[model samples]
Target: MLNIAIAQLNYTVGDFTSNVAAIIGGMRTAFARAADIVVFSELAVCGYYPGDLLEDAAFLEQFEPALEKLLEASRQMPKLATVVGTVRRNTGAGKPLHNSLLVIQDGIIIAEYHKQLLPTYGIFDEYRHFEPGQQTACTLRIAGHHIGFLICEDGWNQPGRDYKINPFDALRRAGPELVISINASPSDIAKRTLRHSTLGKAAADTGLPILFVNQVGGQDQLVFDGASFALMPDRRIVFEAEQFSEDFQLIAFDEGNFTAAGGAALPIPSQGLSTEEFARRQIILGVQDYARRCGFSKAVVGSSGGIDSALTLALAVQALGAENVAAVTMPSGWSSEGSVSDSQTLCANLGIPLYVHPIASLVQQYGAGFKDAFAAPLQGLPLENLQARIRGTVLMEYSNSFGALLLTTGNKSEISVGYCTLYGDTNGGLGLIGDLYKTEVYALSRHINLQAGRELIPEAVISKAPSAELAPGQKDTDSLPPYEVLDEILKWHLEGRRMPQTEADAAYGFVQQLQAGDEGRQLVKRILGMVARNEYKRRQAPPLIRVRARAFGSGRQMPIAAKY
Candidate 1:
């Protein structure tokens, strides 16, 4: 019988001290548990996707010392073999380094396996810094069992479609008793299901029990949902770690079956969180980690009393706590009475302080200055944008004065069509709902209230018509289609085939039906044109927590100058 511990940890990028400390902590726990082996997630040393930090000579210099530290720790727990992911210098052709995994036992590095597949699409660009390893399986014999290893992407090509060389096949040929796959996989709506299906199929087809371990935490726009699990060839997922948090578990493998550490049969994990609940947890973690990493203890959101701002405030309060979150209502002359009242109710429900900074005087001052300087009355579109800009400026001033990170409230629909003023609602350190559609914004707002068993976001705010309140009687529908229609178009156009298969088919069919009529076709064309023209705005917008497969940031790279 072989006992293995899964260390699902959260590592900050470039923080070698904390990362090593966490890894050693896991090792110590595994040692106490009397486990023979402990497996950590990919890049547990310097964190996953270090980007350009891998290019720094000083950054690269820290790895050897970190490994030595791990080696030293391993010497204390001589019986436990520690498997960790880090980087190593490459001597052969191609990149300067390779994404490597090391197996250490009794202060000796017994086995080293370089990652063979380098993923370059979507949010991953591993090929930029690390060279791929040779197409050979890395297997080691320990505790009377043979184990094969794989990095994140190596196990993804089970269908033999993504990459030419199937690492699973090669590992199968080598004939190991089990396979251990380490990953830093990011979370999305259907991503957990995808991982289960893909890896489960691989395990079932190869008849190899696979242990998949992953990291959890918010990294910039990416959120890695740990949800680590062990799969059997016939049983699929038998065990799963917690999602969106750090977890450590020990399992025993004996006679080709995995069980609890005490040799009892492991119960199958639950079906996991719903899509709305998943997004809430993901965004909360994103806000928490982003604020902490950026050196801000508090977050401030401009409260418009609309669904977007209300939801942002609620999520922010949950993430950073009510004491660490503040809401500011910058109502203008055109602002509705419900705006301030709803904001008050929302903040009161959320247990956060609300500050009202009336922006009517500020708008008048800006309009007067513009008329005097430009010799034209600041009315029409410029005047409307001026109110948003003044609110944005006031929010920024509050952020600076109070040392709070400003949270932008623009959702995906307005952002996609360029309905937002660049320097106005777009001005924030981080966007909380930028990846969510306006409809999704409402859905999540309702979800929050339901989860809280009360109106945390205020029912009045959720029921109100979507508006910027920049001009008298202004509604978002005046500038764009209703969110119900607009979100479908944006999804079909922007995400396309990248969406989940069912969602993609629904979006495609909805768009095809719209194209069946001339007015609908014209509407589709106009929305597409708006999206194309809004590239410049999105390019300048703040980075949002990515909950979708194809977000507006690095995932969707569109040229601003070139016509599509």
Candidate 2:
């Protein structure tokens, strides 16, 4: 029997002091449990996806000392072997570094394995810095079991993925009794469930019991949920860790069976958090880690008393305490009374401070200045955009003076159709709800209020119609199709084959029905055109906390000057 401790920890990027301490702390915890081996997530030393930080000479130099510290720490528990993910220099050709996995016992480096698959698409640019490792498998004998190693992307090459090399197959052929796969998998809407189905299939086919560990926490726009688990050869997830938070636990493996460390049974859930709960948790962790990493404990939101900003403010208060969240309503001459009153009501419901900063005077000053300078009256769309820009400027001033991070409130529906002002509402340092469609935004608000068993977001804010308040009698429907119809069209066009099969089928069916009429067809075509034309605006917008599988940022990259 082999006792393995799986450490799913949140590591700060480039913070060698803290990361080294965390790795050592995990080792100590495993040693106290009398475990034979301890496994950590991929790139646990310096954190995953360090981006261009690896290019800096000084940054790369910091790893050697960190590795030495880990080796020194291992000497204290000679019977305990640890597998840690770190980076090593590639001496010969190609890129200069290799994403490496090291096995350390008694302060000695026993075995080493490099990640063979380097993903380059969709928020991954590993190929840009590290060389693809050679096709091989590394297995070590410990506690009467042969344990094979795989880095994050190594085990993901299943049958139809079209990758040239499959590391899991190689490890299986090597005849290891157990496999330890380390990952830094990010948490999206369906990612956790997808991981279970895909990896469970691999385990069943290979006929090997597998132990998976993942890093947790947020790094910029990405959030890693640490739902590490052990899969039996029969495709049953016997033991699992927590999600969206750090967890360390011990599991016993004997004769291809897994149990708790003390030989007790383990209960694994058949399903994880629901879609709405998953989105809520992902956004909360993303926002919390992003604000903490960027050196801000407080956040400010430009509340519009509409669903988007209301949801944004509600989420902010959940992440940072109500005392740490501030709301400001900048209503203009065209704004409705609900804009101010609803914002105040929502803030009061959440127990956060609310400030009213009317932007009608600022809008007039900007319009007059434009007319005097260009000898032309600023009217029509330009005037509306000017009002948005003025509000954006006021938000920036408040942010600079108050030392609080601004949270943008644009939803994916508005962001997709280019209905948002780039320099205005988009002036925040980070966005809380940009990935959620307008419909999802409303769903989340209601979910929050329901979960709280009270009106945390105020019913008036959620029930009111959405508008920019930039023009008289302005409503979102005045220019765009109803959200019910428009959301389906955007989902079909933007998500396409990436969405779940059932959802894709429904969206496709709805879009096909809409094509029966000329007006509906033209509306879909116009929305698609707006999405493509707004690439430049999205390219410059602040980073948004990603909750969906395909977000607007690096997950769905597009060219600014492309035709298709």
Candidate 3:
């Protein structure tokens, strides 16, 4: 039997001092638990997805000291073996570095394993920085058992797939008693289920008990949920860690079975959190981590009392606390009474202060100035956009003076169709609900109210029609389709390929039915055209917390000034 500790941790990218400190601290905790070995998530030393920082010589120079620190710490706990991820100089003709795992015991490096599968699709661009390591199964003997190692993407190459190499196949042939896989996998709608299915099948096929560790917390647009788990040879998950948060656990592995710390049988949940719960946890962690990492403790949101802004404020308060989150209603001449009153009610309910900053005067000045400078009246669509820009500027002033991070309130539906104003309503340091479709925003709002067991986000706010409130009697339906229809259309156009099979099939059927009619077909064409034309606006928008399978920022790449 081998006693093992899984450290599912959060790491700051390129902050080696904190990263090393965390690793050392975890090692001490593992030793105290009387475990033979402790495993950390992928790239825990420097955090995951460091992007081009891997090419910097100065950045890479600090890694040796960090590694030395880990090595030195391992000497104190001579009986404890530590498996950690770090970048190592490749010293070959191809890439400059390799993503590697180092095993240390008794202050000596026992074995080194390099990642074989470097994913380059979607948000991953591993091929740009690190070269693939030579194909091999690395096994180490510890406590009368042989253990194998695999990095994040290394174990993903299942047999009968198109990939030329399967590391699991090689590792299984090498006959290890167990396999340990470390990952920095990001969270999405179906990510946890996908990981469970993939790893569960691998364990069943190889007849090897598997321990998986993952990193948690938000780094820019990506949030990694730490749903780390251990699987038996029969594909049964015996032990699991907390989801969307940092978790640490020690387990015993013997006879292809996993037990809790001190050899007690582990009780595991058969199903994970509901979809709404998963998204809620993911966004909250994303907001909290992003704020802390970017050196802000407080957040400021331009609240229009619409669903998007209401949900954004609620989430910000949930992550940063009501005292740390403030909402400002920058109302204009066209702003409705409920826009301000509902915002006031919502903020009061949550115990947060609300600031009423009317933008009517500012809008008048901008209109007059535009007429003077451009020799034409800034009326019609430009005039309405001017109101949004004035409000955005006011919010920016608050953010700058108060040193609070600005949270943009645009939902995925508006963002997709270019219904938002760039340099206006789209201005922020980060977007709280930008990844959620309009319908999902409403659903999350209701979910939040249900979770709170009351109308924390005022009933008026939830029932009100969503609008920019920049023009007289403006309604979203006046410019775009109803949210129910628009969200479906956007889902089909933007995330069709990545959507769930049932959803994708449904979206396909809906689009086909729409194409049968001229008006519906033209509506689809116009929405697609809007999406294509708005790439530049999205390119300039702040990083949105990704909660879906395909989000705007890095997940989807499109050319702004090109025709499809």
- TM-score per prediction, in order, is 0.99, 0.98, 0.98
Residue 449, candidate 3: C-alpha displacement in angstroms: 0.6
Which candidate tops lDDT?
1
lDDT of 1 at 421: 96
Alpha-carbon runs more than 4 Å astray in model 3: 159-162
Q: lDDT tens string, model 1, 224-288?
A: 98999998998479899989989999999988888999978786798889879999999999989
- lDDT by residue for model 3 over 165-214, one digit each (tens)? 88898898899989999899998998887787788888888888888899
**Native-structure RMSD, model 1:** 1.0
**Better lDDT candidate (1, 2):** 1
Please provide, for model 2 over 1-564, each residue's C-alpha lDDT reduced to its tens digit, 9 standing for 90 to 100.
999999999999999899999999999999998999999989999998899999999999999999999999999998799999999999888999999999999999999988899998778889999998889899999999998998877877767475887888788889999989999999788787788888888888899888889999999999999999888878888888998889999888888788888889877655787777888999999999999989999889998888888898888988999999999999899989999988888888999999889888888888889899999999999999998888889888989999999999898988998889989888999988888988898888889988999998888887878889889998989989899888999999988767777878999999999898998798888889999999999999999988877899988889999886
Cα displacement (angstroms), candidate 1, residue 499, comes to: 2.1
Give each prediction's root-mean-square deviation over alpha carbons: 1.0, 1.2, 1.3
Candidate 1: what lDDT? 0.92
